[model samples]
Target chain A: MRAGDEEISVSSTSGSRPTSKDAVINLDHGDPTMYESFWKRMGHRGDITIAGWQGISYFSDVTNLCWFLEPEFDHEIRRLHRLVGNAVADGHFVVVGTGSTQLFQAALYALSPPDTPHPLSVVSAAPYYSSYPAVTDYLRSGLYRWAGDASAFKGNIYIELVCSPNNPDGSIREAVLKSENGTIIHDLAYYWPQYTPITHAEDHDIMLFTVSKTTGHAGSRLGWALVKDKEVAKRMIKFVELNSIGVSKDSQFRAAKILKAISDGYELPNPKNKYKLFDFGHLLMSVRWKRLREAVKVSGIFSLPEFQSSYCTFTGKRTETYPAFAWLKCEKEGVEDCENFLRSHKILSRNGKHFGAARKFVRISMLERDETFELFIERLSSLT
Target chain B: MRAGDEEISVSSTSGSRPTSKDAVINLDHGDPTMYESFWKRMGHRGDITIAGWQGISYFSDVTNLCWFLEPEFDHEIRRLHRLVGNAVADGHFVVVGTGSTQLFQAALYALSPPDTPHPLSVVSAAPYYSSYPAVTDYLRSGLYRWAGDASAFKGNIYIELVCSPNNPDGSIREAVLKSENGTIIHDLAYYWPQYTPITHAEDHDIMLFTVSKTTGHAGSRLGWALVKDKEVAKRMIKFVELNSIGVSKDSQFRAAKILKAISDGYELPNPKNKYKLFDFGHLLMSVRWKRLREAVKVSGIFSLPEFQSSYCTFTGKRTETYPAFAWLKCEKEGVEDCENFLRSHKILSRNGKHFGAARKFVRISMLERDETFELFIERLSSLT
Candidate 1:
């Protein structure tokens, strides 16, 4: 807390040191910049316009941008609705958000009934979206307890957040969420083709997606949810209103624009041409996965199970699932030791202990291009 | 929720047509852009090396920038930090956020303690920030209640979300927040010179600010808070970690870069000669306010009292302060009638009834520029 100190103290209580968790490769988080082409394709800076719902775009107002942007933005929004709606069905409502993270929070708020009980028991799978427990626990504090297993929770309400092609161990099967009843919420953050090709069941409970992963523009922060039940969507919107007020109109507009690109086949890279394919998010994810697997093999500190067993079904059989990350489980005796070794070398990776997994595993985000990945592989090899 | 509908039905229930308030302005939310800038700011695109703090400063990479971008982009972050930090004190930790709106949520989450008899009771002046009740109700539901008066109930924890120059009503007084055995979460969202002078009372409380109001870059979605108490600060960090997975690193870096523009005085309309002493943010805010006030006078639909009396210390023997909003107690027949009058002309203003105001008034934001205000005034005049 000293003012003159060079490094700001990141901890409240005196601890050994802030963990090198932040420095780790961060494959733990599903940021899509790992693929070079996906990164290059999305890294353009300019205000994009969309068609308006009424007639003219709301942002077309050159000076203040209220009059023109709506009409232009609407065209993009309608296109996105068609694309995302086709992915699911048209009967449901699509509520855009800052990210699926906001939607996830909103789902919890919406599902929770009026003054029910102290510490409401919220249950999720043993291995779930790593943030679910954290976000739930953080908000619910004493108001809710993160009851691990859904079946055991004999509480008033059972809320489960399921992430497909899940984080850390990328094992997402529909059967995994079978036990979720009462109120089940799914965080389909990585369900995009970049991670896995198998989309949600058209009439599944509730699903969420973000343009950041699908388009490799994490900065846009636009995500939406397809909710089968109208009441649930309403409550979620209310929660959003309470949380941050609402998602940014500009970000929403941009997301709608990007969605148009994907539907037009202009955003995604073609898998037929490796280089050209890399320009597409799904294709880029594939390239990063290959590089990551190579790095993991070279590192020798961990062993990845067969892709099939991992249940990471990206583009079809034999086609790797989820390019932006390679969730490598460390079979070593001490994952904490491996984590330390990597951090000391400045190659940051997310520790697996947080995701309800054995400490001996690490989630490495494949964010580096070939050169950086090769350098990382070389450094990783030295660890063994 | 038609597949190709430009405007989706925002509400699930069959109700009146949606207005700005009904639809959710989300001005209350933050982290506006998720991470779309990651690729665009950096020249090479995907996974570019951010020189400091991992892809932070704009100059580290700015080839894909807009025409308005400055040439000296490299020192953007440090400059922003200086600008934001200087706005407050040198010792305070101004961690840039997705937006000040996110910080508000974080502040609430941080203050809500575990093991409470009832949910945490939040108290603010009547006609306080509109988000206070909505945010508390959304998360804690029955656990937390908005105490209009300080004597309503006795709770172990009391968080005062002080939105000075307040939101909706634009009211601020030193006595408004009496930190007697309670935590004061001061939302200094509009305490800049344009709204009011910096009211610094070192009694010990948490304060928040966002670049959105100050810089008119709501799309950037960046804000930060300064907390005197370390425990409170740590909890806020945890809340952020769980919620949005930490503000986008790219946004933070961009924010840091913009911070420099504020500090180096380069952000002003004329940094060198004419507008040397003017802070760009203050100038912009003032310009907008001037136009808004003029429009209000010309139309006479509502009156905008002096900004200081609404939220902060008022001048000339009256000490009142409110954020950049005019909380007008409608002299008209019904609140709904006034709302309809404004809405008929496509003008949007928040109703103060939601903020617990005594009278039927509307809270109009002065964030719009002069020209937009003029058009809105013309429309309002026509309606009248």
Candidate 2:
């Protein structure tokens, strides 16, 4: 595969020829494959075998508002919370979803009252996750409307979305607009110790998390929200029930088994247990970020944000940002559209404009496999 | 368990008491547990074991609009359609979803133009799936509104939903109101040979199918749509992309494996192959429906819809109606609400009012486990 790249001819017009050899390096989606080796090391322990008759019934448990959640999933989620010490799961009700995307929509549906004379404004800080506006406004719901940039918003009743360890830039964020009439939904998808320093447990009224960024199980399409209010949780559950009936139990069961393995690995007594998911993830991400920074330094055509070191409660030490994405700003001449510039070099990246940011910047996924990252670095270094 | 049921005293006002000894029989949800014994017969052939590194990448295929769909899923769907000879798949673009629920919403979203002067009215016949209105109006989306009873609906432009082998009842249905402006979405969720006879291949613009009702894997939460138009298919794909970023690949993979098993069982040379999913499902459902009819006959207070026999292509014989749900009408004096009457007797059912039908009728599920169905029959017979 490495030699095939050199043999294939590159087309300047189309960026890259659709040959078997020089396929375009896709860094557009944040698919976490850095934990591949870690998961592979666990072997059958991390594997999931679902029987034909398993989860034959649609209802998981009638008593719980999130009746779609498997009991093992509920247990694993609580265990992971206790181990990470990131979220307060005791009082909060957990609502499962297809992914954090569904939960994000569900949160909007739950937060906004249907009888509101005007649709409740949903706002987030600039350079937000690209899907926020798209998901919120696509349906054109009368209950809520996307009001971009919370900093400039002056709504009486609004829903504030806070994506901590923000998607594009990877900066730890909070609600910019403070108001008594506002309800906040914290998207803690990238709040794990591997991505950034965990300052303290987030006890927000509503918090969102996904197995996609956490355990690199994006294909599983599993996510959950921790909601403080029972009514809100019930509403979210109703939204899911009406949306997809419920989250897939097969995925939930798989997630539970994988999460259990991760929790067990984290609790291993030996410091050098090697099976510890967090330690493995942290080390891999730290190394990848270091290599990426070094490569970018050599290129001198691009610049990355300088993230400050912070104390992490989980690691009991200071650590720098190890984000899943590299927010790259092209400093070269005639590179106004950084995404197009990267595309010309056989690389695909998400445009910063999509995230309500400047066209000079682009978001590249650092969660790809090591081989893809290496090729990306090689292609990027040539731009110097 | 039988002895415990006999020992517990039933409450008239609140229905069944929440005690460890007496558990309520949930006949409300159409969870297909009738295929449990059939699946058990297949043993490991029906089991799905996913490795840790399997489906690690978020993107399944780049060319497809729904990039998260596993290729095996596409293949299995085509195979199943060909085997059943129900829906056209050759020229149609297949869009995978979380379930038919998401697909239904997607169809609505895709059919309605966002810039239209008013929301497009979405309608279905009376006794439609109970979730239609709830799912449509829950978000209060201005793109579309739920207009009940397609027969009485008058609209210039609208999307009509047609659930063949209609839910809450066993009657084979067709669109009552025909208009060129009206786009039809055929939900073939219960059109399998086990539930109803497949008269001919349904060549609708948009046809929906789910693994939940077809294979009794309700918890997997996987569904697909056969869309004839490329633009509409793309729009539906966009809905799913914005909804959950695509369906779960883990569930899709499992669905593919199970679907392959079913197809393989069907294609076996020997007609006596007990592992054939359709045959097994048919036999189980036929016997169950017969027993249920006998029990209802004994209980003269209840009456069931008399369905005409139809020639089944799959079975190569005429078959009576063996529906996933038994739409029962209470004819006893003082029984105004059939669901309430059944609830008072310790049987939980879905009220016909929920399906936009009269309160005198209640929908009882025929998809429960053998033990539960037997208990339901015994209790129903005692009510006579």
Candidate 3:
């Protein structure tokens, strides 16, 4: 086994932290292990029991256009979105995918015109998610090609990806490059009340969200896309069909159960069974952010992006954004590569170059277990 | 709701078949609902219990190159393969996929040279898997393009797909095209004792297998690739990483449990435990095939492919093949399109044209539930 990965798994699962000099705190990727305790507290409420004979057929509900989607999952998804008031799922067609990663590619495939002479231009902001380019261009698909940052892209017809409360840096985003022929796909993966304020119900033409970021079920690899246009939604479904046949039904079952638990925590009549997921998420994130900010201040080596407080429609309170990642800028005179600087100290962070940003900025995950987070803060505090 | 789809679901679930003319017998898709009874027989032994907190992390075993693969799954996959003697798993890297569908595309990506000036040509023999051309050409990738009918292909360099105990017709196959620079990928999805004779253990450069065909867990959407070359395996893993980040860990967990149960049936010392999956599968398939052949003979309208008995190494007996599908041909003097003729009679089957064959041939699923299969036989028997 990867020794580093073993240490990370151990740190997340158990309360004990290794005192060895080589326990590298892996924050390079967003693993979402921080939510383990919340689910543990949930006990059997979070348990997903699947019978062997159930879900044996490939067909779930064939009456719907998105027939691959389980009815329970569809019901739970719509219920959760309506309860949170983040996005409208009432009139939209829901296409399930392996994950938002697959859905992103599906969105690209759906939006890109197949008969175009040249590949359709795909762009996002400079500090865009690293995967947009990597996933799009890896296959060198003739349907679409990456065209770098959206702000600098000059195109008449293009597919622009708008990741709101964007990755690397949590900033409210909109279509930077607009044209009548241009189409926009909103990656609302991090738009939940815990990550950002649910200011209003988003009414986008095409929106993508995932269970990985929402419920911290990264291993589930489940996601859905909401498309206003029927033709686009059908095309996305075709893409999923052509890509992986369909999403995993077991994951869908588990996701449905988890989502039902979350919704029931808020709306259930039983007073003794109260366990609000968002409240737990919000408080935990706030505490972690506070600790991280203080550690950064004490070290005097790095600076974090400041977020403004806004009134949340769901929580009915004013709160600052607590992004899943920390966009830390290395303020030191010669620290060009912040990722390297952090890696040197046994704290792994993603290089900004990967996100099409300057090397001075590095993205660190704020979602790790307390033991790992505490160790990270301890390591950062002594860096000066 | 799709009325036809709903009816099919009901037929698979309930024992009753609708007498209404509108209830279409959907043998068009291989839903694998026949195995539901086997899993039902398994009872709680087939149950998969997943804690909400467990498998939240993206990392499973980072120590391995195929980092996203769960350790339990890897172990169980090797154990099962060894138990069956279907393919050589030792000294090969195992890469997990959403399904064999995703793994097929990943195999294409791995075989193709990304820097090639022109798209790599992908070819397969006639009556190939219907999805071969559809999935390969859907996106029209510049990395590779579908070049049909490998037997007729004249090329200096190409990638050939070899699906043994082939899809439309159950014929054991080997690569028909060969060249110095050519690559071969084996789709051994149906190379099990139940579907065909286990003549020998398969040891190829690249081999693909799926839970859908093996254990009949179509809804799980889990598959694995055994690759001999390190670089090729790495590329395949990268394609999966880009395609969907990774396969569903919940599905992986369930697959592992199912596989463990399967192996335990054969090798476990407990005499009380006597459920052998292959033995169950072989007997069920044989009875279905026997009934289908008798019905076809009595009707004198349709003809199915004839098979030669072979000595099975696993069973240690001469056994006739029991294919999952029946490639039936219309023997009527005037009928050219068998699919259309079947559709008119409320029996849905896949048109042979989809598999790059003549219109007179139609592929019918033989693995439906007992009620559906009986109805199908009754309809076939009633035909003049």
Candidate 4:
């Protein structure tokens, strides 16, 4: 049950060298590893030292509409939003969650009427985040049911989870189904300057964001939602309270510290500081995306969807899609299952079928550590 | 919006003096404040300092059945179990959760079949934890429904949640329903030596524990369940994965540090260190209970349930009831609602009706800070 045991088992089963086709290298999980060097550069500045008695109270600030939120967390969230200039913070209530995952479920719960004649349909576009359906339908809640593909969905009283800078293909997206009955939850988890251009200060009715994708601190398990409607925010808070009482204050405290550090790095007066989290993150991701595209071009056996460059206010420059994941479509006629093809080459990938896409497509994580990504690129290059 | 604002509001609403009967002091929340001194004594030993890059991996150890767990958390859980000797850790799998609240839901999700003809009945004894029904029926999931009072429940296929040293009224309890179709979840949240006598090592099929009651770290929002069945544990893990992906690693890390400090204090060769967490907690709670009883004795308007002294293996001494909450019954004439009576004096206590008890009774949390609890006692004594 130790982490060492897992490493030993994987190494033993897959062999040490990359020459073995079946050697295991998990590139399927969307863990953000691009910030490792950036954080390492920041050193103890990003470290969180919590006192034993810190946040001992179950309730953080009782007056906060979202009472469970740590005050520091509330401040840091607003500060981060202000720095990013991606999401509007004013006149919005922030509901903290374990992650965007919990927030997604909470949003679904909040949007749907408890006594609806039929379960409200929850639809995201095809090639959506795989967990959307699983999370929505797991309990088979009477409140809501996963109704796939918003583009094709013809329904009233529905929840459309718009994951802009979408998961699988990293496409900049908008709501396809527009109706008063449709509640759009804009999951702006990847709308950070590192991933895509901040078109404008998004003022969606309900918007979701997570530190996991923003700073590659997935294990922190911190996310928040900005809701225009107080009632919706209250319902979302109630859902969290019933689900887990509240998000971890320890996590919230750490997130606040990390977020502050990120903001400080961004606001560093000296341009030569080299520890600008946003700049570091953007550079790292941009390089990774460039290297991946070049590798795909050299391989000639896989293709990626071309992304249009757009001006980003945060960086004040035009940027291309530097997604946390690379959705690859196998160009070879024989490779029906792109996942299996990648698996054969010692690369573990999430099949596009899980994302409600064709079997010819596979999602490879672009968030792996440098050494792992380099090896993946080498192995991918050999496939040609 | 801020903690300072909340403090100001409370002070503004109720003058800062204890002489006034209409001075507010919230004694409704069972936030264990006894451990604050103990943790403060431990100082940096109990403090958690997590590096920026620590726990960046979404998956900690794949070889571990609970993939989301930090190895240190697993180790700390076992160590704490060993130190307490109230719960058996051997031949069990540990599933970390957001809290015992989330774990409670997870256990129900794991126990109930997804394709059952009817939702599995979830039952708890009368005067149970109020959150049970609220959490279970929040979504009105097709998988389970809250069936009140296991004592009256006649159903065969059901999930019974047994909260030992039960909430509201502190009483040692077991499963009231003994059907083979029932799956029992032992919520040993307040089963620590400070609250109750740890007479024997509990070897339930599924047992729950939380730092909230154990270490007074409710804001940490961390809990662990020990399950004897691997399949059940796996299913519970799946539930957590769908619920919030996983518990917070930041909280897990902090819990591990705090638990380690607790264990260290117990295992210390030098008993003169005066930092033993359990001994400190027991002493504080014992003093509080004694003071409360004496105060109530003078007031003569309220009554507390008499608890028998029991031989505790942890302390190797007979211990009286030092429950986290005081279940008080108003003996005053024409006092139909004890909560309302207390609220009239600006002392906030949970109404007994919330716990499915008589309107004459109320639950006052003895776990508040010393100043607040003292103020509550002053208010109660004034009512006489």
Clashes of each: 94, 0, 4, 0
Which candidate should be chosen as best, given DockQ against the real structure? 3
lDDT of 4: 0.83
lDDT of 2 by residue, B1-384 (tens): 112111112122111222332456767778777767888888898899998777666667765655667899999999999999877888888899998999999999999986786889989899888878777777778899888888788776778888989997877889887888888889999999888888888888899999989998888899999999988998898788889987898888889989999998878665669678887778888898898889888989999988999898878899877889999999999889998899787788888887878989988888877878888888888786
Q: Supply candidate 3's per-residue lDDT for B322.
A: 95
> What lDDT score is found at residue B191 in candidate 3?
93
Q: Best candidate, lDDT-wise?
A: 3
TM-score quality measure for candidate 3: 0.95
Per-residue CA lDDT of model 3 for B202-254, tens digit only, reads: 99999999999899898899999999999998888878888888789999999
Which residue pairs overlap in candidate 2's backbone?
A: none
State every prediction's TM-score relative to the real structure.
Answer: 0.69, 0.93, 0.95, 0.94
User: Interface RMSD of the predictions, in order shown?
Assistant: 11.9, 5.1, 4.3, 3.9
True-structure RMSD, every candidate: 9.4, 5.9, 4.2, 4.6
Alpha-carbon error at B23 in model 4, in Å? 2.5
Q: What is the C-alpha lDDT profile of model 4 across B1-384, one tens digit per residue?
A: 112111212112221223444557767667776567667877688887889877776776777888888899899899988888899999999999999999999999999997887899999999888777777887878999988888889868899988989997899999888888788999999999988889999999999999899889998899999999999998898888878878899998888888888887778675586767778778888898888898899899999999999999888999887889999999999899998898787787777777767889988888877777777777666677
Comparing 3 with 4 on DockQ, the higher-scoring candidate is: 3
Q: TM-score: which is higher, 2 or 4?
A: 4
lDDT of 1 by residue, A1-384 (tens): 011111211222111112333332322334444433442443442224221111111122223111212233445544644444324535655666666787777777667665655655677665544555656665444345567655445544566666666665676645333434466666666655445545433456577766555555555555677777877877776665445545554454454544554555533555544322223555555665665567667766677644542332333334455534555665555445445556677755555555555556656656443444555565666666
lDDT of 2: 0.83
Docking category for candidate 2?
A: acceptable
Off by over 4 Å in 3: A1-22, A270-274, B1-22, B269-274
Model 3 clash number:
4
